[model samples]
Target: MKIPTAAGFVTLMLFCLVHAEICPLSCICKPLGEMKGWLVDCSSKGLKEVPALSVSTRKLYLQNNSMTTVRAGAFDNLRNLEEVNVSDNPWNCDCDILYLKLWLEDFSESSIANVICATPASNERKPLSQLSGNELDSCRKSLPIKCLDFFWRDLALITFAVLVLILTLCALRKHLRKIVLCV
Candidate 1:
């Protein structure tokens, strides 16, 4: 076999460096034409926030990290994001986190169900789906009046049915008494 030429080796090294720069942090960024997903695995990296990713990234994994605070616009550029896992991170529960929590809740394909808070707060380790919007706003600590409205609607329906049944029973009793008296 012939030895590789000096010029060929230098060109190969330059190509490698250029390709490495485009790779995402802790991820294998593969460009599949103009429309395809980039895979990211950022677990256990002690990342405080998500790193810059290509617009092609659809699935992201930031689990088991030291991330304490995620800024509002951290994921704004990733419009194609379909799945994300930020589980096992030490999430700081505050009003600032409200936007991300609410956005995750509303995202059609995102699954933050396992993402939990690690803190001195009451909702620690709680699944996000199990918590109501008011409970999620526990930092605010005031329940929304919508809960009361739901309660009243159910109560009113039951009360109306009971009154209708009572009136029907009274009419039946009166009619039975008249028949007995006639007999």
Candidate 2:
């Protein structure tokens, strides 16, 4: 009976060790009971960037870090995420931050309420949830320079087409009048 108990303990220990190894190096991960998911805690790590998270993360804590922005699709793999805290960080609310804001809005609206801007002076301390697309620094420049080039090229083609149509009408006016007189 003792030998069987010891073997069970060893098996459990090995399982736990392997499970813990799935967590990111910069964060702490704990199972959320019965294989539901993990509770990943990366708060107050002074992290400049979001650490890679386990796919099974359900509750993520990233508050009080130095992170300025979360890359686009950073949390896409966490299909089981139920809650996330990204407050108290120096989030630079620029065009790059749009992804985080939009993601939070779709994932959990309440989470974005506490996310505040920490850069670009005008947006400092402003709630990320309150920011409009126009408020972001480079968002207003959404139309690229290449788009302008296309606009100019299209305008020139339209103008040339109109000029050719006018010339054709002028050249045919004498024939039109002759036809009218004969009729």
Candidate 3:
């Protein structure tokens, strides 16, 4: 019985060793009870960027990091994510962070209430979850007017109307000249 217990302990140690490689070098990851994934704790690490997380990550703690921006679709592959803590980071509330803001909106309000904007004085300390769609729209870069916005058919119709008006005005002027000549 003692031998079997020792073997079980060795096996558990080996499992933890193998799993250690799955976590980021800068972060500590531990499994939750009976859960299928890890809880990544990367808070207060002064990390400049988000650590590479596995598909098995359930919760991410990144508070008090130096990350000012998060790349778009950064968490797209993490399907099991239940909570993300990104508070106390110097968040730049700009177009770069628009994706994160939109993604936070998908989670429960309580889960996202902790995410606050740290920059753009107008939005400083505001909860990301509470921002309205129109308010969030401020983070998106405005689309420039492109030729595609106007249909060719509409332009053609306007051109045709202008040509007809010019022709009618010219004919009327000619008729008026004739009438003046007759007088």
Candidate with top TM-score is 2
- Model 2: per-residue lDDT, tens digit, 33-87? 9889899898998998888777889999999999999898898888889999999
Q: Model 1 residue 22 lDDT?
A: 49
Which lDDT tens digits does candidate 3 get at residues 1-183?
355688889999898776775588889888886757889999999998887788989989999999887898888888998888888888777667777777877765665677788777867888766665445545444654457656776789999999999999999999999999999
lDDT of 1 by residue, 36-77 (tens): 766677778878887877676777878888886678777877
User: Global lDDT of each model?
Assistant: 0.73, 0.89, 0.80
Ten contiguous residues minimizing lDDT sum, candidate 1:
136-145
TM-score of 2: 0.71
CA displacement after TM-score superposition, residue 129 of candidate 1 (Å): 3.2
Worst 10 residues of 2 by lDDT: 17-26
- Evaluate residue 137 in candidate 2 and report its C-alpha lDDT on the 0 to 100 scale: 93
Residue clash pairs of candidate 3: none
TM-score versus the correct structure, for each prediction: 0.58, 0.71, 0.65
Q: Model 1 scores what on Cα lDDT?
A: 0.73
